[model samples]
Target: MDLNKIHNIYFIGIGGIGMSAIARYFSANGKKVAGYDKVKTPITNSLEELGIRVHFEDGVKHIDLAFLNKEKTIVVYTPAVPSDHQELTYFKNNAYTVLKRSEILGEITKNTFCLGVAGTHGKTTTSAILGHIMEPLKATSFLGGISENYNSNLILGDDKVSVVEADEFDRSFLRLSPNIACITSMDPDHLDIYDKPDALQESFKEFAGKVTDTLIVAEGLPLEGLTYGFGDSAAYQALNIEIKNGGYFFHVKTPTRLIKEIEFYLPGRHNLMNALAAFAIADVYGVSSDVIKKQLASFKGVKRRFSYKVKSEKIVLIDDYAHHPTEIKAVEASVREMYPGKKVLAVFQPHLFSRTRDFIEDFANSLSKFDEVLLLDIYPARELPIKGVTSGWLMEKMTLQNRKLISKVNLSEEVLKSEADVVVMIGAGDIGLMVDDVKFRLEEKFSLLK
Candidate 1:
């Protein structure tokens, strides 16, 4: 579809991170933009601040008259939206052009030199780092998460180059045509959609086939590509790693040369690998090693990837979007590494009932590493509860001695009861919305003790 011919773009789920980025892109390009979401959020507020009209209700009357013109308008909806959604159904019944969010992203980046970052995890951080490195090249980046550096998911630039987080949910990444791409991992996730781990692997292989110029994979992944990792066999390897002052200082060996004294601020070995992946992609694109190193050092990070809400010597609080078993283990390792000998409390909200049921034992084992655990009810974003999938059931499977199933209303009280030195709240759902209140109560309680 020729986007130039479309003057008005209406989004059915405008508050989503990916959808809002596309909305901002069209709004910035002088298109008349508006949309409807089921709830108002910070994302919708930001869109409204840009003069884009957004409403919470989902009705035909809520849509502006200008967006009703079928010839000049197109409707974009996310896969998470229900099929019976009123606005989406209205657009379909009226024979208006309706497309999935992934289809529109594919169209937007089709002609550009696209750098797609695909994986079950680490895609957001890797893509954000690559976007920062490519900013001088005038690359427009559509990120899956808000970048702390740019403070927006859409990093505006010229249309010649584009960086995007190629999502694997619903096989969305298959729609993207990338000139250069990287698969950070192929962990078995979204089991509700793929039903088996092998199918997910095959999907990644299919996406690998679509890479026109280059495909980079993490070492040990079952794909043929220039590899990046800490091992000596990788095409791009990070050597002599050192952690000091809560960041990493390392040297890198590229295909052509050795770069010395590369600095990156994000914590965790998983994050170090993310940085290496981005560095390899940019280096292959002909960006100078020195320039990439400089950008990596200056990169802040993506919001909620490991955001520090409150950091002090006496009390520490961290928020992260780690919903998968592997991701939770990575966060646990990072916390143990950062605060050695200190008691750490992990307050976690399981994301989906199917996911929790599929990996119940794995989730229990990962959450057991913390000194204390407070489990919240599963945040069922797109799925209903299974027969026996519940937080209490999962908590019973955990071996951790100091674990309890808690309610959101008593979250702050339960958290304050723990005398742990550090508190980490991990989830992908509305637990993010609860972090601020938790932080405020923590500060107040600590101040009273002082």
Candidate 2:
């Protein structure tokens, strides 16, 4: 679809991170923008402040009459939205030029130099770090999560280059045409859609084939591409890693030269690998090694990916969007590495019912790594609850003795009652909404102790 003819863009689920990025893109380009979300969030509020109309109601009346014209208006919706959504149905029945959020993103990046970062894990951080590296080139980044450095998911810049998190959910990344693509990891996830792990891997292989230019794969991903990891022999690698002042000071071996003493603020070996993938993309794009190192040091992480809420000595609280087993394992390893011998408490809210059922054993094993575990009822973002697949079921499978199923109402209280030195809230669901409450209560409790 030729975008020039479209005058107005209406979003059915604009509050979503990816949808909002595209909404901002259209609004910035002088198109009349408005959207309907089931709930209003800080992201939707930000859009409203930008002169874009946002309504929380899911009714068709909330949509302005100006967008009712099928000829001049374009409709975009997230796959998360139900098929029976009134506003979405109205657009479809009226023959409006409706497109999925990914389709719109594909259209936007088709003519530009697109850099896509894809994986079951680490895609957001990799894309964010890559965006930082390509800042000198003024690349527009449509991130899956808000970057702490940019404070927004959409990084507006010239159309010379675009950086995006190629989401594997619903195989949405297939729509993108990237000049340089990086696959951070191809872990099995979203089993509800893929039905099996092999299907997910095949989808990734197909995605690998779509890379218009260079394809950078993480080490050991069964695909043909230049690899990046801690291994010295990898095409791009981070070696001789040392911890200084709670940050990683490491040397990266590029194909041409060995870049030394790069400073990275984030924790976890997984993050070092994420930075390596981004560095490889920068190198492939001909960004100088010195500039990559400099930009990487200043690159702050994404909002909820291992975000530190309280970093004091008395009580440490961190929040992360780690619903997957591998991601939770990464978070646990980072916490243990940073505060060795400390009693770590992990509060996890399972994201989807199918996911909970698919990786029950893996989830139990990962959560058991913590000293104590608090499990919240499944978040059920886009799935109906699977019978017998509850948090209690998961808790029972866990090897840890100090584990209990808790509700959001009792989340902070349970954390305060635990004898843990470090608290980490891990999930991709509404558990993030409780971070401030948990942090405030923990702070108050620690202050009273002092």
Candidate 3:
């Protein structure tokens, strides 16, 4: 399918972070863009403000007649969409040029100098950093999360170079043809799709083989690649790491020269690894060490990836898109490291029932590390409720006696009344949308108490 011939791009799940980026890309390039989402989010609203039509209903009737032409319009959908989605079924049955979001991204990057970032976690932050590094030279990036620096998930540039998060869900990363790529960590996730851990690893190994240029991996990954980490042996290493100014101050030892005194604004050792991966990829593109160092320090980070909402002395509130056990642990470590001796309360909303059921023990152990835990019902993004799997069930398994299961309706009130010195909201679900409201309510509550 020649993109030049396609006049309109329609997204079935347009409000998704990744999908909305592509929608913006097409709309900017003279393609009439529009689509459907199940709910109205800031993302959907942003798209509407960009002159792209967005409807919340699932009916084909809502699709404009201009997009009904099979030959001139391309229909892009995320794998998260249900098989029975009415608009999706209509496009398939009507012989429209349908493509998955990953497939469209692959087509977009095939000819460009593509820098693909793949991992179970840290992909968004790493890609956002890499995109910022390459932005001076005009590299377009379709990120999984909105960058605080750019204020948008898509960084528009000439088609010469591209940066993207090579997603692992549904084996989507395999479709990308990256000129240079990095695999941050190949942890077993989405077991509901892969069924087993080995199958998940196998998928990553396969994606690694598709890289046309350099392949960078974390120090301990099984695959033989240019490794990046803190240790001495890796090709790109961050040595003498120190936490300063509530951020990381580190140096990168490239295979060529020692880049000294790099300033990173994000917290945690996991983020250090993410920075190293991006630095290695940028190094491969012959970007100067000084330039890489400056770009990194200036990088603000993604919206929900350890984003701080209120950092005042009176109250501290942070939000993160951490749903996995490893990510949750990293968040806990960072919070505890930053505000030691402070009572930390973690408000967690489990994303999917299958994920909660699969990582029951892991989730319980991670959440127990917090001083107090408040859990909301599972978001159930795409799945029906599991028989015995629930947030209440997961909270009961937690060893922490300070845990409470609450509904979204009571979440604001409960959070406002909590005495914890630091509050961190952790989840990949709609819980993120409530962060602003929670912050406002907390401020009001503090004023009343005063």
Is candidate 1 or 2 superior in lDDT?
1
Tens digit of lDDT per residue, candidate 3, span 1-450?
578889999999999989999999999999999999999999999999999999998898888999998878999999999999999998999888899999999998888999999999999999999999988889999999999998999999999999999999999999999989999998889999999759999999999999888999999999988999988999999988888898998778888889889999898788878889999999998888778888998999999998998887888999999999999999999898889899999999999999999999999999999999999999999899999998889988999999898988889999987899999999999899899999888877677233
Error of 1 at 19 (Å): 0.7
* TM-score of every model versus the real structure: 0.98, 0.98, 0.98
Ranking by lDDT: 1, 3, 2
lDDT of each: 0.94, 0.91, 0.92
What would the per-residue lDDT of candidate 1 be over residues 41-105, giving only the tens digit for each residue?
Answer: 88999999999999988789988999999999999999999899899999999999999999999
Per-residue lDDT value at 317 in model 2: 93
Off by over 4 Å in 2: 448-450
Report each candidate's C-alpha RMSD, comma-separated, in the order given.
1.3, 1.3, 1.4
Model 2 Cα lDDT, one tens digit per residue, 1-450: 789889999998899999999999889999999999988788999999999999988888777999888788999999999999988888888787889998999999989999999999999999999998888888999999999998899889998899989999999999999889999998889888899759999999999999988999999889999999877668888888998888899888877778888999898889989998998998998888789888989988999999999998888999999989999999999999999999999999999998899899999999998999999999988778789999999998999999999999989899999989999999999999999999989989888334
- Alpha carbon RMSD to native, model 2: 1.3
